[model samples]
Target: ITPASMTIVFLSITIGTIMTMSSSNWLMAWIGLELNMLAILPIISKPKTTRASEATTKYFLTQAIASAMMLLSSTINVWQTGNWNILELKNKFSTTIMALSLMMKMGAAPIHFWLPEVLQGTTLQTALLITTWQKIAPVTLMYMISNNIQPTILVSAGILSMIIGGLGGINQTQLRKMMAYSSINNLGWTITIMAFSPNMALMNICTYIIMTTPIFLMMTNMST
Candidate 1:
């Protein structure tokens, strides 16, 4: 039951990501986020362990807050700019808010405290999905709007993610938590370089995926 529920959750997140990546309107993106959050809630809570339940509550609460912030930011953007088009994010402040929300949703630094705990509570397969597939949509959106996003903010997030990730993982006993932190570190590398060159950002993402895929596959095989 757990595995099946997790599969459904994965599918929902994938679909939500697709919706978010393709949508040009702010409301549509919000719907996609809602879908992603709702889908993953079941997976987090299904383990039926005390730690798992606690992690689920944490994940859900954090996501809800992020979602609310995103909506508020979008509303502010629309009110100030008189446009709902995400592509026309001319208001710098709103764009910053949106970027921050996205970073939070992706489990980036400062807002990343929930990730290790959540990953620790899940199975290896679920962790793999969280690290990889769940990232696709948010990263795609980040890349799309990179031109408009503030360089300072991006750099700060990237550096914080790298430092926190590395320091947090060194003493971890759980393999899942270690991998989660490793992923955060890799995302930091990607975001850090993204500000220097778009081409390098793409390369970083591709390379990270290539390097991580084999490890995840191996873990899955061993777990099975």
Candidate 2:
């Protein structure tokens, strides 16, 4: 890619993520997420291979489904509570839908099937972004609605994620797929603690990034 194009892509991604993180209303958050999703597609498909194209398509479809669910949840909440504020998610059904959508976006639990395939098809740097930076907005949204979502669902998904992540990676030879499973496992821990302690969930995510970054950087340098 040209330098100008790369710069624009990265800037848009950053701005999109920041917008999602800072937005007070669901509409703004949805827009930010869409922008982020669009910005990352080119990066994921940069290799111009069939696998890259497949990965991009899978990522887009999965994210679009999650985003639509999120918007629908917000609409339900607005209908019930007449509020557009993120923190005003008082409707039980909306809260559950919102939580599930965020978990799907973050590649957690039973809905995490797309992550490994997507990571395997992308370059190392793009994989790194998928596992780390792209997670922040969804996690932030989860955190914001932590009080509203049912703890049992979050805890159940978290436990399932940990188990599946561990079992799924045992036979994988591909480094990117292994990292995908690892991210799911770590996210399980974060989501488990999110309902009980939001601060701890944040800390867990921060630590995951710190620990995972070095490994990805080393792998990239070695061309692995």
lDDT against true structure, model 2 = 0.95
What is the TM-score of each predicted model, taking all chains together? Answer: 0.90, 0.99
TM-score of 1: 0.90
- Model 2 spans with C-alpha error above 4 angstroms: none
User: What CA RMSD would you report for each candidate?
Assistant: 2.1, 0.8
Clashes of 2: 0
User: Model 2, range 157-193, lDDT digits (tens) per residue?
Assistant: 9999999999999999999999999999999999999
Give the alpha carbon lDDT tens digit for every residue of 126-155 in model 1.
677677767776777677778888889889
The true-versus-predicted C-alpha distance at residue 181 of model 2, in Å, is 0.2
Clashes of each: 0, 0
lDDT of each: 0.82, 0.95
